[model samples]
Target chain A: MKYCFGVDIGGTTVKMGLFQIDGVLLEKWEIPSHTENEGAAILPDVAASIEELCEKKKIAKDQIEGVGIGVPAPVTEVGIVQNTANLGWGYKEVKKEMEELTGLKVRLGNDANVAALGEMWLGAGKGEKNIVMVTLGTGVGGGVILEGHPLVGTNGAGGEIGHICVNETETETCGCGKKGCLEQYASATGIARLAALRLEKDAKSSLLRSQEHVDAKAVFDALKAQDEIAEEIVEEFGKYLGHALANIAVVVDPAVIVIGGGVSKAGEILLDYIVKNYRANAFFANQDVQFKLAELGNDAGICGAAKLILD
Target chain B: MKYCFGVDIGGTTVKMGLFQIDGVLLEKWEIPSHTENEGAAILPDVAASIEELCEKKKIAKDQIEGVGIGVPAPVTEVGIVQNTANLGWGYKEVKKEMEELTGLKVRLGNDANVAALGEMWLGAGKGEKNIVMVTLGTGVGGGVILEGHPLVGTNGAGGEIGHICVNETETETCGCGKKGCLEQYASATGIARLAALRLEKDAKSSLLRSQEHVDAKAVFDALKAQDEIAEEIVEEFGKYLGHALANIAVVVDPAVIVIGGGVSKAGEILLDYIVKNYRANAFFANQDVQFKLAELGNDAGICGAAKLILD
Candidate 1:
């Protein structure tokens, strides 16, 4: 009945959880990250909070095997956060510093990779050996797990699927400064942008007049209402998503691709479109691959981080 | 002193090679494949040739450890050439048939994957654990090796880089029945098409007058002569190549990418352009990943097939 701690560090909040070796989450909680000033200077507060939590639960330090932390940036081979664009943290030895304060071995990985690990180990992809998880939020992010191990690549920056080009025409720019990246047209922002562009074209749509501000959710709502422009946007977005996934399938060829994050809440509307287009775009032989929505959702990060320590 | 045999089965030729355990090529030869008529009937000929080659070389049957074959198409999990576009073969159990006839163990893989294995083990990608090999020929084919092993997906159809979509605008139709695939614009034929399209708009080029028939090489020659149209066409072609490579880098993050085949003969003119644009298009952290021409050239298939058995 050995246990471990998993911590998911985010820009606005930090999620933490306790898990047994068998992967059952015993407890979990969230706290403000307060990353405004210099970022990561709040380590002492995090350590103290964890210590207090353990004390209150009557858990001994010896009972916990290790700690795993998922950060929102690339990690060095030795567990240093190279740079977190969202958190505004730069090149810090997170594992060493945290381990010294908490008196436990620490493992660190990219937050997206960790979340994929969680899904691979215990969620939708539990029985699957090969998986590629794409998180479709404000921006798209991805992590690939091949044969049950995360592909960290040479520089530990592997699995940046959002930046992969889906459109070669250079019609849109991505946050990474590249044009025609998949993230520019398939992410939540991408959906919003497409919807806005349709509105600008003076396309007739009842949904456009019903919403004060158009976002990805509004696009999904319009799709629910069967709006032509919304249907076209979703279909086109799904085509790009499918094309990108098909390309990834040709490279990694995972048994299942788990779609996660805020935009994924659109559920079958998005997935149905993606699957149709994915089948049409994928290599003739890879048509049988499955697409599943991530089951763990927000808790996947903590669970995956915890699994890292358990593994 | 253990040795193995490797065979590369192409549309027109069958390349066979012998190699030692330490990645050294001992002997090699090529034979007409004659795959146009009922391809499975050619297996006996391949087996007889192997026996004759061994006998002529005074190599004992017992000294040969195994045989590996690289086929130019999708293979089943058990080493069957399911279907080959170039060879016109369908559902042939090559490995089992070859092993039964030759009295040696046999392994089969896709030709592109085998070439990547060859580069990873004995050529430009030597000593690297992760590599992606792209062959720019009539079409742009690719293979990805992650963590030192070839990526053979569920359907043995992984590494189909040629089918990846580079354009979402649906400007060009690919041979694979898809629109805007990377190969439609990056391969030798793709380059020739671009050259022809440019010639139609800018007919003042010396390239059009210098050659009776315009092709990829003619375009390269014109670029060397500082023809504006040729340079523009080359630059555009290079941009697409770089963009595709950058997209691949983001997903796989291989330590080095090896480019091979006839179009690669453009050498520095192509390499320099691809490198410059790849850096500009790639994510910041991936800018340092190496891109080089494959070292083995035509022998890659034979050597890689042999190395597959050794590995």
Candidate 2:
């Protein structure tokens, strides 16, 4: 049986997994990324971890067809991480360096793109040929899978959906210095921020009584209680999400759209509103597309990385 | 020499052209399209025109390898035009009907998509594989070319950039019944509306003196006279255009972006501002993509339809 290794290199942790060509996960593990270290310092530790896993599993080196790495950075088509704002790395040939260390063929892709690939390959979009996955965590991130392959553009920066402009009135400032980016309103932080602003306006909500510091979960709880302000915020959030998805539908027309991340934990409450508004706002002809919740949760990274080689 | 016939079917007219394998135009003609007539009624006139062209050029029918038609409507992958808004046709098999009339192979595509194909094959996007072409006419229309082919989604609704939501606050209404779409600010009518709104604010500008009624060209002319309000309007217009393009750049990261249509005639004065703002607003890694003015002008429709077979 052919096997491959998939590594998802995040800012703080690196998730690694072993899998067969059919996408069954055999084993998985994690390691501290220590991303602060220079390029040379990080490779030896990564190599050591891989070698330890191979020995413990009694897996032959020849059985491993190739390794696929998902880095939290913008990569060139040829596998160089051009620049990662979170990691502070610039123009690093990650694939070549990892290949040298592990003595195996390696391919690298952006983290969002890889996660999207993972969802398409083994998760909610198992049989889908076209899918768009949005992760609404601390920040908004997305990946586009078109025709059963990741839509990696000229420089591998193609699927940066968070940066897409969601507002034109210059209301909120994004980390990238742009105002009114989608990430400013749709991510976990954005939702919490909206809740806080509502609180400042003296909007009555059950959320303030239970939690000293409000978060996205608090907002969800308040929504369930039918807090007028929380419901309004949720509605607005859903509208933006639906509007963005509708536009994306025009560009990609994917068969399925999977929503993941901390805010997505609200489940049907969030999805119901998104679907209601998406159908109403989408171009008249595209009201029939499907929207679903991503099933893999956090394991999406490892599974996606593993599936890269198979794809 | 091998040749192919490209027909661009519009509401009022049909533009036809013959193209050689080397992407050169061999012959071209146009005919009135009384689209109110049934699809069957329009067939013989198109056939007669093609026969007359062949006779005039002394070219044998066998020399034409195939015929490609670009219709102003949503098309399925199988060449059926599904309810074109302008043509008022419902579920018509354009390729099959044209093939029966002309006794040749036929391929059908959306008009905007075919125009992008034309630009990719023989215009500004020559030699580039990934491109996005936006036509800023009365309403915004877009085409996306990825990996050298027009990206026609499953429902054939891909490349609908005009409908992408650029505003979250819902300040403007779009013709598509959406709020704050990119078309509300970037298209010819959108610019004229902006200029008229500025005039209402009692802003001082030569644009007021340039024309009896405000239009996109009048705004450009006023900007040339260094009118403060016109320059500000142009600047604001540029920002919106830049914001939309930046979002598009993040999603597709095309090698080149071709801007066409009536508003594009504003030339460098408009392009310089858009390019500068786009660079500032784009995701950090995608700063190197090129933006160019489309060169094919009005011939894009026929040429694009022609190049579909060659591509």
Candidate 3:
């Protein structure tokens, strides 16, 4: 009857979950992330929250196995995060600090990577040991889970799929100072940018022309309404992301590709366009790879973080 | 003080090596490959070869660890090769057949994959656990090694780098029935195609005009002579391979990229063009990935096959 805690640390709020070692989540909650003062109080606050929960439940210290953490940064094999722009963290020893505070072992991983792991463990990619997860939020993020483990590379930069160069002829730069990255075309913001560019280039009679704010949702909504211009925009977005994912499949050969994040709320329709383009671009032998929408939604981070300690 | 055998099953010949478990090559030989009878004779031949060698060396049965085999096809985790165009094999149980025939335990892997493993063990990628090997011969072949083992994907099609569609607009189809795959421009034959296209379009003054047969070697020879058209052709080749590799780096984040095969015979100069284009297209975090030439040459297959048993 041992239990564990999974904590997902973000810039604004920290999500926490208590679960049995077998993965039945008993309770879940959130607290404001104190990123001020270089995020010095972040880990300590998390430790105290878990301690309070155990006290309230009248649980003994030995009843808990350890804490699993998902952080918004590249994490070294030893649990050191060299840089986290959102958290104002620089070279912090996340694992050691959390262990010292809670008197329990700790496991840490990159947030997006752990989310992918969570999906593989109990969500869309359940039972798949080899899977690739693409998170299409404001910015595109990715996690490659091979053999049920995240590929944290040489500089802890493995699974940085957003930065993959999808187009070389472009002049504009990405946030990471790269030109024509997948993030420039596949993210929520990227989809909105496509709609804006489409409107500016051609004066096509479409429903999107009347919307004051044309976001990713607006584009999908327009598509549902059979807007011709929206179809073109989604097609272009599908080309970039699907082609990039096909290239990824060639290297890692994942059995499944799980699509997640804010943009994924558009639901099953998104998979149709992506799967079409993916089949056209993928290596023939790898064309059979399954595509699944992430089912755990926001809870993926916490669930995945918990799985890390169990691993 | 243990010994092992490495067998590389090729289309024309079977290359065999006897090695001490420490990786020292004791002796090497070759045997004709009889593709008759649906290649039914292949495994029995390989088994007999190993038995004869053991007796010749007076090596006791227990003195040998086992035999490792590298085949010219996609191999499942359990050592079943579903298809092999070169070997004329169809759904053959390679491991089972070999073990039954020789009465010795055996390990099996794909030829290109084991070659990548061989390179990682004692060649250019020595001591490295994460690496990507690109073989630019008649056709492009690839083997991805992560954490010191080859990435044998779901259908054993992992590391099929050649078929990654780099240009979606290409008119001519690749050998694999794909359009604009990496192999269309990166293989030795691909390099020759680039030369032919350049010579036809612009009618530029170049050393290739005087050659009887223009091939990859002729193109490199012209490049060494500083021919303008040759430089352009090589640049085109570099752009396709370098950009595709940059995309690969974004996913796997390997520490080194080892170039091999026939085109690599041009030596250090080939790496210069590839590195130039790769740096320009690579993600900033992964720009530091090192590039090296394959050191083992033809022996990579046998050496890597031996490594399978060791793994």
Number of the top lDDT candidate:
3
For residue B38, model 3's alpha carbon misses the true position, in angstroms, by 1.4
Candidate 3, superposed: residue stretches over 4 Å from native = none
- Model 2 TM-score is 0.87
lDDT of 1 by residue, B102-193 (tens): 88989888999999998998899999988999999999888998878788776787788888766667666677887877787789999988
Ranking by TM-score: 3, 2, 1
* Single-chain TM-score of chain A, each candidate: 0.95, 0.95, 0.98
DockQ of each: 0.58, 0.57, 0.76
Q: Relative to the true structure, how large is the alpha-carbon lDDT of every model?
A: 0.84, 0.82, 0.92
10 residues in a row with least lDDT, candidate 1 chain B: B202-211
Interface RMSD (Cα, Å) for model 3: 1.0
Model 2: how many Å of interface RMSD? 1.6
Q: For candidate 1, lDDT tens digit of each residue in A163-228?
A: 887765666567887788888888899888888887888758557667888899988988898888
Q: Estimate each model's TM-score.
A: 0.86, 0.87, 0.98
> How many clashing residue pairs appear in each of the predictions shown?
0, 0, 0
Q: Which portion of correct inter-chain contacts appears in model 1?
A: 0.73
Tens digits of per-residue lDDT for model 3 on A1-311? 99998999999999999999988999999999999999998999999999999999877889988999999988988999999989978999999999999999899999999999999988999988999999999999999998888888877788999988888787888988879999998999999998999999977799998999999999999898888999999999999999999999988899999999999999998998899999988888889999999999999999999999998
